[model samples]
Target: MIDWLHPSVLLMLGMLPLIWLRGRARQIWQVTLPAIILGLITTLAAGSQLSLSFMGLELTPLRVDKLSLVFAYVIGIILIIGNIFALQVEDRAQHIAAGLYGASALGVVLAGDLVTLYVFWEIMMIASVWLIWRRKTPIAYEAGMRYLLVHALGGMLLFVGVIGYYLATGSVAFEKIDVDGWAFWLILIAFLINAAVPPLHAWLPDAYPEATVTGTVFLSALTTKTAVYTLMRGYPGLELLLWLGVAMTLYGVIYATLINDIRRLLSYHIISQVGYMVAGVGMGTALALNGTAAHAFTHILYKALLLMGAGAVLQMTGRSRMSDLGGLYRYMPMTFLLYMVGALSISAFPLFSGFVSKTMIVEAAAVDYRGVVYLLMLLAACGTFLSTGLKLPYFTFFGKDSGLRPKEPPINMQIAMGIAAALCFLIGIFPGALYAILPFPVDYNAYTLSHLLKELQLLFFVGLGFVVVIRYAGGKDYIALDVDWLYRGPGRRLVIHTRNMIAEANHDVRAEFMRFLAKLQTRLGKAHLDGSLLRTWATGSMALWTALVLALVLVLTLGT
Candidate 1:
């Protein structure tokens, strides 16, 4: 019998019925199912394990621990929010894709062994690309293709790494690996790719903006965060991640400032914010790891809120570029209000979720005595405020009047954002609620007077600079090229040229073979016509041969 109560199984099962259901039924099913999953996840006790045998190997597909539960609870909550946001969408496929994508991520979090994690990891990639494709635009299609290809590469590396690790050690348990050997490096690279670390990071901004308005909300929540969870589980304390994480924070903020599309701007910040979690994991201290988990949970809520606001703008105005949008706040007052909640939360403003969570990572750097890293992270925080907190909303909602008046999005959309916005505020006000579920005990306080003063000073100056240079700070309509240019430009041309060369060679070989066959046929026809090999003289020749063979047979018989 199937374990219908299994969290992943329940999620997948809920989605399969969506294909056949429609209208009110589908919406109800999708909404209620996630709530149910959330309830189930909360009830799961830590140290719970569900084991089975597969191919003579013991497999634990469900491993409930504090770490996995943290990811599970947040993922479950996001599923509800994303489903409610998408309630107005008639596309069942999109809902199914979002559900499966969340389920797969949850599966990875709960997986007890490397093989189980890899299985869910690959599924997560496959399910997510569809959200991008569901937009049904040419750019969306291309972006989806790129997203699929990058993750496929990551999946391949992960599969090979799993095999190598299994061979190196006679186990496939998913845990912190010793930082040495081909297996470790390969696995780490795979995780980094999914984590959107640097050059492997291009797929995120490339595809996220192209997804359907509602789809981007779910896209924003699950994939990269899941990779961060895996990093915390399997690769924490690897010092290399410390620097790489800081670099991502700066890299994302810079591009986010320059980007034109609203969703793209938000997408880049995903990289920037995830950098903090990555850096925390690298720190490997109890506080840092707790910060990573706390920030991840809070980031999901606030980031989803931010994306939902952007998606609403896109849905109502049918434009995502800040260059094409302005003065939307007058018409979208509620949207503007809720979006600011998220903005303040993400900006790490005092008395907000971001203030409570993001500071922990920065404080972790300080606690570790890494002054240089601390300063660089502080610099990235300034950029975050400049881009995501200031420039994005300013131009998108309050910049020069573009004379476009778009009303607020559907009620379901507002409710979704409300849920996320409320969570951001609640988490901010009640940090203890978030801290209680952390894998480690919490000892740090985020409400310190010194910390508050420091963050306030940083934001104040960043805001001042933006106001002084407001004209130059506005977004211009242009695609900023990133490292993806290598693949999307020259790399694409190389593939086309190689394909053309192969086609030419194939044509020549086929033509030559045809000519050879024709010549052989002609020669065979001539030989048959020139000799008595298969002609009308066969009767007389056959009779003579028969008589000679008869004489030889008689002589042989007599001799014998």
Candidate 2:
């Protein structure tokens, strides 16, 4: 019903035909041009909004605010970058899925009402699974199915929560509300699931590495960040989030440390990155909220950059397991450089994007007097430095030489990495550009002497620890147990066992019935052979036969 909502609708419709665009050039334009136009429109009229009413429900399809604008900007920008990264891909399905997936994310942030938000939420879920599925390997197919199954469960939770909310309050607008009962908690669980908060998080690390190279980039950037945006919008200051966020940070680092595959390790690292943002939302101060928004923006860029670098290695060498890869720095030095930028940024090294943004949240936790929480956040930061910043890059690019040579990836791919790498530095050096657009005003300085020295010392010690233990710190190629083991391991065995028991019981019942039938047939044949069935009714004989027949009927009817 919103007039300017027309552009988003039209853009999404435009993507449908991309499924048939087989030519590489057409794919590029199809994926990138609409994103460019949408980005332009968003910048030019960043404050525009439109709303409509139907059946006593209010809907705002193109709501624009500072929070929505930041999320919209990233998804729009990433669309172009992601497609450029995927430019040489002949798979039209990836292009279509990426376009619609980006559209749904943009729609989610812009939607001012629950109806609009939930509709797009479901669309986003369905579209993303295709990206994994289109990888077209057995692993990809199975991972995609599991991914779908999990999100579908989340969607059902959201559906129930939304309906219960509207029924309880007679309002369906997507705004902050008191957690009165089942409605709020149900919806919260759904968001946490999407955000990859701990027990619910296995789906992300499980499925992302299985996606197409470019698809994983989009996957890493969009879904979890959308949850961050929504949580900031609707659930800031919720106390429970503090514990959940910290748990994710620590849990992710532990798994990421033990993970062997490069992309899979990075996938686990995402839970750590998102933890900072979620904890920021929980802190509920202006500084913390602003930091969450800033981190989300910067995280998207660097995380995508990391994935792009990993994808480059995967593409060139056809190997992603670090044990099978090394010494590629000599062959693909540009990749090494771009990848290190991402690593440094994510590690929150001084003067990189992450240091500038992530410091704000840790500061917020301190200012709020959440000292224990602050300590945990600090510990998680150290773990991040150990795993992502040190171990991943070392094993992939600089560690043991596996004697495999791989060239730099395609120009478009390199350009994508370069652009992302540039933004990581750009935001770090010029924090004001990112700060200016935050929903809250920013006054924090990240580069003051104490802050810089503190961050450097932390990184230094973590790096030293890694160096001292390098001989014993190699990645093991064994699966690390996680919450998914319940379903995929023991839970699966339980279901199969229950099914087998039921099958065995059914077989026994059938066998008993067949045996009874066989016995009856044998008795009838014997009776016929002896001609007892043609008994003459002599008085005593008839009386005795009738008495036997009555007893048999009684046994069959009651005694048995």
Candidate 3:
């Protein structure tokens, strides 16, 4: 029955019982559900469709194809791993939110029509906000509100686009939508917002680090990757995305280098790494598209692994800033070693997952003769190694001891990290395994000597430069201003200033009106006292005035 049912329904309905379950039963159910989802995902064949009619429209809630299948497979895998990692957490609501969040992502990828996609898209926004709010901190609450507002705006754009598209074309198919009209542009902007493209990306780093430790893992795995999936499905080869992706690759790393929060640092790199997939989608070649899918899959794994490591640090020490963490390798050696695997994988180190996948995008750019794009990607990769591989780990685990000695995270967490790290290495060592699942055939090799040497040499120089600048590379206790600063800083002040100005103007107007009323009252009092008008006028005089006014009105009306 689970296999026959849509994954979204199974996950949404299945997670509710978790609220009533306790202890081991909750843990067992949490882990069992994702496993069941994975099994169901495997059973799903491409071209499978499940549809029903609603409001005279056919809504396909389950539509399986190569593209959707790969995304579903990865989502299912991350859910199982994430649920295992979260076994020790006591909050059932967090688990439920994560489950619904994941179910919403599954719904988006499997949706066969714009209506189904939009429905899931909105649910994803609603469910994910709870993960941030679950932290119950003021900062988390504020961040979650901003996150919700941004996503809500995006959802509105998506809704408008879908409505416009349906009205114009009389179809709701969620397929390749070109950028020829307002509807397409609205849909594309909506996707870009979810993709965390810069100017629209502050919500990610602002909200993700504030989430519950385990919650960040799920947050890292889902939202942007889902956006990438939508882009790959709907807007591949859009030249604008190619340039925007290239800029994001650099913009993210630049900020990442300045970040002190370990999770926040990793969060910026998400934008950086996702830029690769976005670039590949922009290139629009078969090779580029395959590379995009591969990189997205691998990114979810290694990024989650990195966040798990950072979460472990936060859980044990109550500190997430690298300036507050150092010399932790001795106390958390397993954590250190496991986190390094993720670091290397994200850095595109040889025999790592990123080397297999990330290089594909760079290679795609080179093949397309995108010289500027290729060089920028390489530069971004160097920053990735410098910040993530060398800077973050060095400051967190290897730099001067901050006098904090914390033990490793729980066994289930270590197991989850181990599983993800192992998968990263395995996928790197055997690229064919990941490549086999791609929507396109593989004609690429990640291990060619030239490619290997080029990557190694790049990493080598980056490592050397980091060693030279080691003192300057450590985290500092300062906030780095980002695009969000515009709204959080000046934009907020502008609103307050405008509000104050309006209040002042209102006060001035009210005071002036009262003065005018008082003046009129005084004048009337003067007339009454002086017996100049009403007091002095006889009844005959008043009646004669009224009769003359009436006679004038009657004469004017007769003449007209």
Candidate 4:
């Protein structure tokens, strides 16, 4: 029982106070108080691991394995940074939501069993949607509903898979299962949905951009990364992931390229980044799995930093679309610089965090001689460079001056972005610190002449392609369709059409029934009130009776 009171559990248990306080006050203390407690717990319990049994299963609610520790560490770090970013806002609701959100993510990563993991997984979903709804906009409300529905569906699928696994194997363990059955596929589908793989990715861009500035940063770090953690644990070497990952990569890039909204573009790129991690996990080698884990660790930092930078722009300017944003670098130089660091890292530029981590996955793929997979990954990298790394910063900060001058965000926001930016550079320059915590042995070198030259060449050519496309291309429209178009466009129209048909059919049926009733009523009124039909029947019956009696008398006399 004492073992269950590990750091994460203790911090989670402590969240009750913060949740209660949200109702009374909307202050920084409401959020920072919980975060302070959580950070202390994390620092004190860094090397300790704990577990307990529940329901005849040995459940480890707290497992400080190297893989788990890296993510746990990052979640803790992000929580602090996010709190700082949101310090100016007086809404304690967002604060409490962020705390629970961070705690739930940490719970999922540290869990050592399927049931335990599922418990935290569902909690994370609930907590995250609350953050989305904190925006208090009509769009935020609608997007939150869609977000909740999708995650609920994923949870149901995961629960079914867990039950099926228990019934088949008589064990509720969180280890890799043989992927040759219905149960494994069910679990895979659930994780894939959360990972935002292609078709199921509509919820992310739909909901994320609608969240509050600070809320989106928290949202960006957790949901998909947790899915990545699950994939690392449950479905390594699942061949289908390679194809799915590639599909997500291309799909995200294409959609991101066409988007006018800056934050939505970043949301799409999140799917793209997850694809790399998914593909790495599919490779299933120790190095590949480690790469996937490391990439996830770094991806969260850089992505959040980018989102934070974008959030600052939104907070200051009250605008998010690229079309409405331009040349703020002169006014918000620090933000622009910090955002550039994040962008470069994501683009896998040399001496950046992405260069060190993402290369491991690409290298793993190349070593495996997956020709098509490698080619597609390279193309996707180029596409990422085109859409997010180049397009986002270029359009938002460096493009033609739109003549808008907004002051820098509040000091806390700068501190948040500054911390994240520093971490991005630190991880890239000295990857050994990050690599030391990987689940496996660390021997892979991130920097080499050949690797650096190849990456630069790839990025260079991709940049050239972008310039050519922009210059020679006549149609430079800023709108691209995604999988959501199915639901929002044709699907919505079809629903409306079907509803109209049903309503028309109901009206026609009601009118026909009324007409029939009226006709019947007329006939009944004539028969009952006038009594003509009844009188005729009585006269006919009497005549027939008299004729029959006379005939009978004649026959009787003859017989006698």
Candidate 5:
């Protein structure tokens, strides 16, 4: 069964080229059909494993444990929904790239060995960049290049680390690991870069918002969450992740609050949101890891829904800045309502998906006596509401009429958002359905009098602050720098200065050597006139020496 399913899915990868065929129906089916087949393979492959030996290394191309299954299930669903959302896109390359990107994402999670994971990881990075480049904007192209460079750096780290680990352990299994040495640190840094952890995080916001609208939806779903999945498998309960996660949570919130463009705002929010999952991995408790997986599941759904909503407005109005959008609910009521569902869900409103999964991390923090971490997570929740929930929505949907009336997006887009919004709500109200596929058993409940009251009060106060933030915050479309400043600013200047200095030094050394060679040539050119005895009587002396040698040989023969 595993043998047939794995090859069948790989065969589906070949069908992406069919999207280049004429007719809208053919293109949509080209991508969607493959997505449906992969989904079916995921469902049918429960408790299955596929193994092979290549170059003396054992490989697990397909592993269907609970953890891998849950991720695969979500990946399959996202591919279909993302394809459906992209149905109206006529760019065949976008469709084909998105399809291949999804295939690689599924392979990444299902991989049971480091070699398999690395192959899929590289494919994923390569395939997703086309989505950004397909947009064909100066910003998108430049952003795509930066995105490739960052992920390439991460890939190099991961590759070297994998080689070193195999040398040390003599195995290639993908499982839990410790902070052994440079190899482990290299691998960990690679995962952290993908997870969008601070300092290594700027690539996400730099590149994600630059993708084509339909492409951004798929972009939001795949890469970073795949990193989270790898982290769960490789480095669970590593204590440093706790503070790193906390910093990411706050770092994203602060920057997101200041950002004006809707997509960029949400891009920073990705950094913030993934911080929760990273924090969960840090705690490394069964509950925390379960929550990490579950939250990643929900974040993908609601975040896609939110992006779909934003993309709808941008698609219709030709603008995405909050400063340029207002009172849109008058025309795009369906978009407004659908977008709100995502906003509420991400803000962790009661009976929403975030409410159910986000607290699992906080609860883990609390139980583990991480009081400081608990407070920071709570503040991040408030900031989540203030920025994404209240600020983004108010200015876009209801703050003030911007005098631009545009109709709703296409039906396919609405259907896509509806599917995603439905999943967000369904998982929130009934987390057990989502929990069932988790790697471990879950018995915790999210609703209690104290927990409910605290969440409400926290959001309520944040809502009040939003009233003030709107009056002053996000009123301008200005850029604010983050950790990216180190490289994009002083670090870039330093590189240029260092190159110039090396070039100048090379010029000096070459000139000095040329001068020395000229002097040596001058001395050799004058050697004939340097007053040597051989120069005075060269011809006469040569003949006399030859005659004397002959005469001496004759006299010696006579004496003998």
Candidate 6:
């Protein structure tokens, strides 16, 4: 019974006071309070493991295994760093929401049963919406509502799948179910939406950029990563993920390349990175899953780092569009350096975390899937380099210097970016530490002649393609469409049409009702006061009443 209380729950419960004290404390303390609670939860969860059963059902509510540990640890670290990044802000509501958001994510990763996972999953959705709402703009509000609706839809699908699974299999364990039926497919669809799989991925770019700068960092780290964790946990061997992953990879890269907004480009790249992890998970080999896990861990660090750098720029310049931001490298040297490290790491350059982690997934694809899957992944890798690795940093920091001379970000923001950048390099330089936490043993070396040559060839050719595109048609006046176009274009029109129809119908109904009432009043007035109808009715009623009384007496006697 005591074991079921789990250390994470206890730590979160402990945060209640600090959250209540948020109003009275300094901004730093308010942010740090959640960080402290998260750190304590991570520390306490380190070695403890327990499970229980109730009502004839086995309940593993707290499973601190390797896979869970890695994510829990990364999420905790990110939360603390995110706190530091957001420390200067004085919004107590954002502080509390961010704290609960991190706590809920931690709970989701650590949960051992489907029921518990679902509970935490919903909590994460609710808490994260608050982060977006913290932006406090009308656009942010609209984005948040859309984000909420999408996640609620996801929650509904997941709940239905859970119910079906329980009915079909009579168990609510979080383990993988057979992907042979509606239940499993429902669950997969739910996860796909959360993973920001294409067509359904607009919620990310729409919402994340709308968040306050600090809020975007935390937002970037948790939701999708939690989805990745669930994927690794529940659907590791699902083959459809391989192709779905490829689709997501290419979709993200193309859109990212076309995006003029800096943060939107990063948001697109998030989908791109998740695609790699998804591909790895789809491969389902020990090395592939390990790569998936490691990539996700490294990605959270680097992606958050990237967003932090962007956030710093936004904080200093109040601009997020790449066209509007450039050449700040002169004033923000430290941020530029940190941003470069993140970009390099993401590019999978030698001696970076991405090189160590992302390769395993690619290698697995090359070996296991072979043929088109491998080729597509290779192409996507190049796309990754073009869109994010080179494109993001080049345009923002080094491109033609947009003549903007903004001051460096606040000291704490720089520190946050620095921490993330350092970790990116450290992990790349030494892969063994990250590898040790992987769910499976890793035997592949990242730096081989064949691998390096192949990667360079792919990247170089892809770079040339980007150059050609830029020279030939990159500036052409054309809009690349996304699934959001359906809603933004057709769906929106349908809504407008429906509203107009309803308004017309309502107006007609109101007019008809008014006319009918008017006619009834006129009739009543005429009958009662302006005609002989009332007098004739009174005389007729008296004759009819006398006849009815005689008829009733006769019938009563006969019946008796």
* Per-candidate local distance difference test: 0.91, 0.87, 0.93, 0.83, 0.87, 0.81
Candidate 5, 1-560: lDDT as tens digits: 54446633563456555655767756557655756566566555567788899999999888778888777778778887888888888788887788778888888888889999999899899999999999899999988998999999999999999998898888888888653779899899999999999989999998888899999999999999999999999999988998899999999999998898999999999999999999999889999999899989999999999998999999999999989999999999999999988999989999899998998889989988889999999999999988888888889988889998999999989999999999988988898898888888997789888889999999998888877655687547788887777877998899899999999999999999989976766676687545443244677888999999999999999999
In model 4, state the lDDT of residue 518: 72
User: Which digits, one per residue and each the tens of the lDDT, describe model 1 over residues 272-308?
Assistant: 9999999999999998999999999999999999999
* TM-scores, all models, native as reference: 0.93, 0.88, 0.90, 0.84, 0.88, 0.86
Question: Worst ten-residue run, lDDT, model 3?
Answer: 527-536
| Over 4 Å off, model 1 | 1-4, 529-560
Q: What lDDT tens digits, residue by residue, belong to model 2 across residues 30-62?
A: 656766646554653456677899777888877
Worst 10 residues of 1 by lDDT: 529-538
Model 4 spans > 4 angstroms off: 1-3, 19-53, 469-479, 493-560
Tell me, by lDDT, which candidate is best. Answer: 3
User: How far is 381's C-alpha from truth in model 3 (Å)?
Assistant: 0.7
Residue 538 displacement (Å), model 4: 48
Q: Residue-wise lDDT of candidate 3 within 1-560, one digit each (tens)? A: 33358988988999989979999999999999999988888889888888888998888888898999889999999999899999999998899999999999999999999999999999999999999999989999999998999999999999999998888788888889953689999999999999999989999999999999999999999999999999999999999999999999999999999999999999999999999999899999989999999999999999999999999999999999999889999999999999999999999998999999999999999998889999999999999999989999999998898999788999999999999999999999988889988998989998999998999999999999999989888898998988888878999899999999999999999999989977876888877665344345788988999999999999999999
Candidate 4 lDDT by residue in tens digits, 351-440:
889999988888888888988888888887888888777777777787778788999999889988898889999999999998987889
Report backbone clashes per prediction: 0, 0, 0, 0, 0, 2
- lDDT score at residue 50, model 1, on the 0-100 scale: 86
Q: What's the distance in Å from true for residue 207, model 5?
A: 0.8
Candidate whose TM-score is highest: 1
Residue 272 in candidate 2, Cα distance off native in Å: 0.5
Candidate 2 deviant stretches above 4 angstroms: 1-3, 44-47, 499-560
What is the overall TM-score of model 3 with all chains considered together? 0.90
